[model samples]
Target: MSDSASVDIAGLAPAVKAALLEVLIHGELPRAEIARRLNLSRASLTRITRTLVDAGLLAEGGTRLMAQTGRPSEMLILQPQARHVLGIKLTGDVLYATVTDLSATAVASRELRLPSPDPADVVAEIAGVAREFSAEYPDIVAVGIAIAGRVRQDRAGAVVEVSAFLDWTDVPLGAMVTEATGLPCSVENDVRALTVTEHWFGAGTGLDDMALITVGVGIGCGLVVNGRLVEGAHARAGQLSHLIVDDAGPYCDLGHRGCATSMLVNSAIVGAYRVAGVDYEGVVAAARAGDAVARAIFADAGRALGVLVASVANLTDPQKIVLTGDGIAVVELAGDAMRAEIARRLDTEAVDVDIDVRLWDFSEWARAGAGLAIRDMLS
Candidate 1:
């Protein structure tokens, strides 16, 4: 339609635009550099930036330029404190929350034990956490909440199906959180929100396509393609957890046998450990001790994971594959076999793909949540 609309920041209403500018207000950049980075013309960037400056979302500064540069160019910086947002991560056992400024830096954080896993109670607790954070950061504009269980759009962002994991079905969670926190709120699938964070600023930042596999209590994969996180029409795209590696390995919660998760997930390994009469923690210690049986269990999971990684690399053709999660504690024992299996499963030259195995701590997850809030502001 018009020039500003053509800037490619879709879904960015004026409020969102002001929020985005506020995120950049602390860091000054030249007009031409900003245009180049954001893929907008200098004229358009200048106009919108001036508008943001006038709105107090950004500040303009200048200095003398070299003779070839004619004069020192004025610079634009984001006034990050102009606004802020809150992020909440709810899981089966823990409630991790953060208050972040427009730049996505953590201002405050809280990790409290969950009172109960009940959906309403959990949502209420989440809402309470948001309220608490908002009271501390009075300028907070919106909130981004992430849930570990399945969250989907029943009718487009209405959070119709929160899935059977936490028994959250057709719950008006977004509305509830908004009403409780007095801020616009949006709930996200935890892994997908984490993926969005990674795709934009972490390991996958510049790659047009990549994937993150979280191997923990559940096997999760998040895929990005063509510079956008893949959100399938059904919002169930990267369910690589149930890729059916064995077709008969073990019964999975998905009612499938030998799924990737069933055969290779942490619980699955615990099952394997039990078969050998060892506890899960004992198994990790034994693997560290190079116990053959413990090592084999880790190897089995790694091999299964390797095949799945090969599948993702082949199917998505992503340039990078990042492996992270709580499962990585034993990954060292399984990594070699997994690598071998990945090589074996590749049909072609494997695209010369690079794989990064990482261990995600609470801070990274919190940062991902903050990044989600930042992304919400940008959009």
Candidate 2:
């Protein structure tokens, strides 16, 4: 495999980059189809593909029969192994890491305990992991860090504006990691990073509009509108946690009663069950085993989730809604109530949206970071 660092993706012309991205996301496609999708003339498409193929960023595979015509055309595919990136997901107490190729497919992963919440210490640990991965995967070209907080990116690089879990604010995390590891680096909100991965290579592929809702210790959302990820002015475009669902619901830390966070989060589910020493998974198991109280709690949470989904659909009308994270099992346990609530809120006959439930692990989040790195390189 060629070293991605030597390719200089940012130096590619806009049309060539778009052509590469087109093949990267949609897999192999005939040159005619690529030209049709990108609205490029045959000559322009040929030049773009030639440039990418010369760079080893794309390759021509076996021929495919074109539907529009009876002739066969060469299939263009991404050289996925041409580039590798290190992705890291940071939580309060642990770090998840992965090495992914150009397509954001995780090839290897590891987990490490955070020795401290201190920013300096965290940076050191991330550098250590970057070094280890670089030694094993010499093609790794960049690093992407995903955290649960607000992030701001400018020419100066990315900064963690606020992270409750890490208790950090205005930290130049991207530059710090770059300086520490001698590699290009970028930072993004964990949920938003995951949305990028989904949009390009996972569940939301080929969709111009979508929403990803994550249920766990908290309720987080990521939105894509008009083929672009909505990063609000403050980088909090999809902040749906505090949206009120039930006036009589529980209270979040900000004292919002009956909010999405208060009703649908893992803690809320466990608290609603009023069970001592039981975790969210335990409660889910009980519900599955025919425990009435547990089932009722899940039902309530599901209803809240339905309300949340309805609100997103009502506002953005996304083509699909992706439900994921560690707490996604609640969807299976209380699917009936959730679907009913959605039906009650939306015009079922007029609106058709696909809801995809994905049981993702921490390593998936790490791969999201790699996706961000790939995006940054291209941009």
Candidate 3:
């Protein structure tokens, strides 16, 4: 196998890149199937696959019998381990890191406590981690950083327009990381990164439209429409946290009363419990053990979340709505109320959107960074 760095992925022909992506996302497939999926002639598909194979990005694997033809056909598979990327998810206090292959499969992971949230300190930490991983995994080609922020990608690099959690504004994070580590770096909003991971490999795979709503320290939403991730004019398309849920509920930092964030976020749930020093998990456990007060708080939060989900469905009409976050247990504890609210608000009777609850894992967020790196490589 050759080094993946020898292949200029971004310089490849568009059709060849598309063919490679199809194989990467769908796994091994017969030439006829790949040609059909990509709308390529058999000759064109052969040429594309040949280029990828020569570049060590693809391989011809074991044969599969074609049911229609009663003939054995070789399958083209992605060379996932040919190269690797470092995926880092940065929060205020911790940095979750993982190394993933071309297919965005996590092979190794680690966590580091942030000594400080200063941009310089964070960049240094990221550089140190990237160097360590590159030394261990010599094929590491790029680094991707995911943070809760508004990121803008331009000719220069990815810029963090704002990251309220880290008090970062107008930070040139991508360029800094790349310069620090001697590798290409991509920066993305953590929620959008997760959405990309879902669209490419997780629950939303193969779907043209889907929504992900995360309820945790903060409420966030990511949307995919018409097979594309939606980044609005200002890169703030999915800011549904402040969407009004009730006029009489609690207030968020933005002073919005009964907004989705105010009603459904971890802090809000904990605050509503009104018990000294009790965290969100404690409240969830209490609710599970049949504590009325805890149950009521979760039920209210669940209903608010349902309203948000219904609103997303009514507006975007996604095929699925993924509800996930560290605080997602609220959905299980107050599922009945949430479903009732969703049933009441959805305008369409013929179309029932699938709501999937995924238990949160910080490693998944790191994998999202890997997904972004994969996308950057392809683009």
Residue-wise C-alpha lDDT for candidate 3, range 197-284, written one tens digit per residue: 8888889988899999998888889999999999999898888888898899888988888898888888888898999989988998
For model 1, state the Cα shift of residue 95 in Å: 2.0
Stretches > 4 Å off in candidate 1: 1-29, 36-43, 54-82, 117-120, 154-157, 247-255, 275-279, 363-366
Alpha carbon deviation, residue 34, candidate 1 (Å) = 2.8
TM-score (C-alpha) between model 2 and the true structure = 0.95
TM-score, prediction 3: 0.95
Candidate 2 per-residue lDDT, tens place, 317-338, comes to 9999999998898899999888
Residue pairs with clashing backbones, model 1? 24-78, 25-77, 25-78, 25-79, 26-78, 64-72, 65-71, 65-72
In candidate 2, stretches whose alpha carbon ends up further than 4 angstroms from where it belongs are 1-5, 347-349
List the candidate numbers ranked by lDDT, top first.
3, 2, 1
* RMSD (CA, Å), each prediction: 5.4, 1.8, 1.8
Between candidates 1 and 3, the one scoring higher on lDDT is: 3
